[model samples]
Target: MTPTPHDLPADLDVFLAAAGWAGATVEPLQGDASFRRYFRVRKPGDKTAMLMDAPPPNEDPGPFLRAARWLDANGMRAPHILADDAARGLVLLEDFGTARMRDYLDQWPDDETAIYTAAVDALVRLHDLPPGPFLNYSMSEYQREARLFTDWYCTARDLYVDAGGFSAAWEAVLGDLLPRQRPGVTVLRDYHAENIMLLGALEKQGLLDFQDALVGHPAYDMVSLLQDARRDVPPELEARMIDHYVRAAGVDKDTFLADYARLGAQRNAKIVGIFVRLWRRDGKPRYLELIPRVWALLERDLAHPALAPVAAWFDANVPTALRESLGGRFEA
Candidate 1:
């Protein structure tokens, strides 16, 4: 069942009272693509905090709490957890204010390069840290994610694709990369513009929506940032940021660039399927609008020689007409 604000726990007030905000004004905020919902808690004296209601059976606050603590402890800017009730699935977190990187960029387009530079710096800092306590982003995981394109996307488009070939192609492409991911850095799977909050300075990028963090290749998060699904990051800027990260992290340029394209293709494919599922199954058609942009990014990723096998699979299955026609066909 999809939870609404009215479906909030009965003891929510009691939980707030226990947390020393007995009568705070709780204003519901817009939700993301999950069962979890957030509320802005404001009290007398202009005090503020964010409340996350991740109800049980469908959602869990454990991973979010664990990741939050780990990021905060490691000198990162994840929101501070003020209070939590794991059994009830409620948490009080520090409010990082209203300056989201996505919105900020929209207002100040001239600051794009500088802001992206800081974001790249943040990734370098994070990759420098030892691996966090998280599940490994193994080859099986990559395969499972990539298969979503065939499973949901092809099915939704009423196109009969070779699902087995899709799997084999991804396996061939990602096989060599998996060996490099041993004891990998923490990959905040959804590390993109909207999830990054700008706290005072561009360098102070506060992280969010990171419950699904995994130990994976350093290039995954970089791809997420540069090849953003929700926004149009200029190709020139993306190239510059890749150069910046390669220099800052002291990694082999050729290997990292290949891995970046590989991971970008994998992630973009997964997102295309997820958006379709969100619309067809979850009744959220707005996500369908993002498919065209994602397809463009995915095509760019497929241009790399590292993704030749997967590229062949796409060429043989998902034709150019269907790719370009998504916007007209899937309108909400």
Candidate 2:
């Protein structure tokens, strides 16, 4: 039987006691798009830790634990796992504190350049390590993800698009690129600002929500950081960060730039479908408000010659007016 929210606290208490955190005061933390829940556990003597309640069936703690171990062993700043009960889906983790990269940048906009540069540098370092024990971010996976646009967004907008053509377009674009990404680096699929924590200085970026990590192109995480759906990264800043990574990693500028653009379009398209699904299927309408921003990013990405096949598909199917008018429509 699935555990409801009401029974979760009781289960958490049992897990906490078994883990020797019996009386830790638990304060609920804001959850993400997934079914997992988090709580800030506090006890006397200034002890504090994060409680991840990723209940079984709907969610699992295995991937998160595996990824966390790999990252921590690699000298990256994934939160330290203090205790874990994977069966019940409870994990006690070291608290990274309240300064998320998104919130921090909002408070001090002047620090944007420095922080983003550090984020790019972090990716540079991450890519240097061998790929983690995860599935390859293969052509089929890319096609499947890109099809989310046609699956959810197009359906929500009542657009009759050629789903097969959509998959074919992605294949044509991403086919040759796959060879360049062989033995690829670990791509933290969700490497945006909200999932990153500012630990202290620019060098200490704490990673979060990386359970879905995959071995993919180095450029993929760079796109995730710069072409964020939740926040607008300045165009000039985005370009500079791209250059920073290319120079630091010593990759050919033109090739990396092309891959970056292609991945950006693909990622943005997937996000469009995900946001729409969040509303239509999950009954969370606020995600729809971000569609316009994602559309703008997608338009920018589609301008690249590398994304022409997919771009052509969009042009013939998704009309400009329909894309622009997504604001305030789904909310109703």
Candidate 3:
């Protein structure tokens, strides 16, 4: 299902020609589990640009294009949209280069703290930005995303859906919990290691795959960064990072911890299901390898006792084999 560079539309030739360019070469860029495809472009005497080959009909570049403009105006760095055909679903972008935070972590282990700290700070700034129409991610939206866990993790895997109570309980919890969150700023839904690029000592951060941003809790992005499933951000370091945010935000510890735990648990549950869907639907089983770490994070945040019922439900009904496969017992 992955499309190659050769699959690009003939419009590419016209666009390149219109720009008065010569001797352009295209190289397939890194991919993610989405309808979009990217390629790096090489043009003489200029900085690099990216070619977006979004699949027709199924995916639209409207959201991304609008978001890019919104972010650019708001002191954020989203790729500028150069050209586009709404019907064809293609657009050119400012290339953010090929350095992923995951790869960056692979190269420099010692700089983990600094890099993650920078990302956290970036997240805080995004969250604190003035509100806009595009920023809205209301309760209905939260319910929809949270439902992914039940759909994929519970139903697709057929592992456990305890007592018919899980659904109602989760819904009830959201009904009560969601109102507590203060929302307004933009949330780059996937702010983890993969979407961010460490561009040369993090001076100019490279942001990609940010079309799904929503207006949600400020703590939500922080939870995504500190409790990333893809990479190992040490527990001690994560704690310190949270503390740093607390100091920066100038909020009370108890209030911040409660929101952090609630949203962290919420995000991780969604990710557990997301990885399941990635494996089952997208044929990307490698993501399944991180399920355990995400589950471990889920358990840690669930220990707050607010999630006691949800924790107990998982304990009684979820299969031991699945627990093992995902990454051992919660107690472990």
Number of the top lDDT candidate: 1
How many steric clashes between backbone atoms does each model show?
Answer: 0, 0, 1
Tens-digit lDDT track of model 1 for 1-332: 33455766668889999999997888788999998889888999989999998989889999999999999999999999999999888999999999999999999999999999999899999999999999999888999999888888888878899999999999999998998888799999999999999999988999999999999999999999999999999999999999999999999999999999999999999999999999988999998888889988888889999999999998899877886664236655
Against the true structure, candidate 3 has what lDDT?
Answer: 0.74
- Kindly report the root-mean-square deviation of model 1 from the true structure over all alpha carbons: 2.3
All models: lDDT? 0.91, 0.89, 0.74
Q: Write the per-residue lDDT of candidate 3 for residues 249-309, one digit (tens) a residue.
A: 7777777787777778778888888887887888888777788899888878877866666
| Local accuracy of candidate 2 as per-residue lDDT tens digits, 86-105 | 98888999899999999999
Q: Which window of 10 residues has the lowest lDDT sum in candidate 1? A: 323-332
Give the lowest summed-lDDT range of ten residues in model 3.
Answer: 323-332
From the highest lDDT down, the ranking of the candidates is 1, 2, 3
RMSD of each: 2.3, 2.6, 3.6
Model 3 sits at a Cα RMSD from the real structure of 3.6
> Model 2, residue 254: what's the lDDT?
98
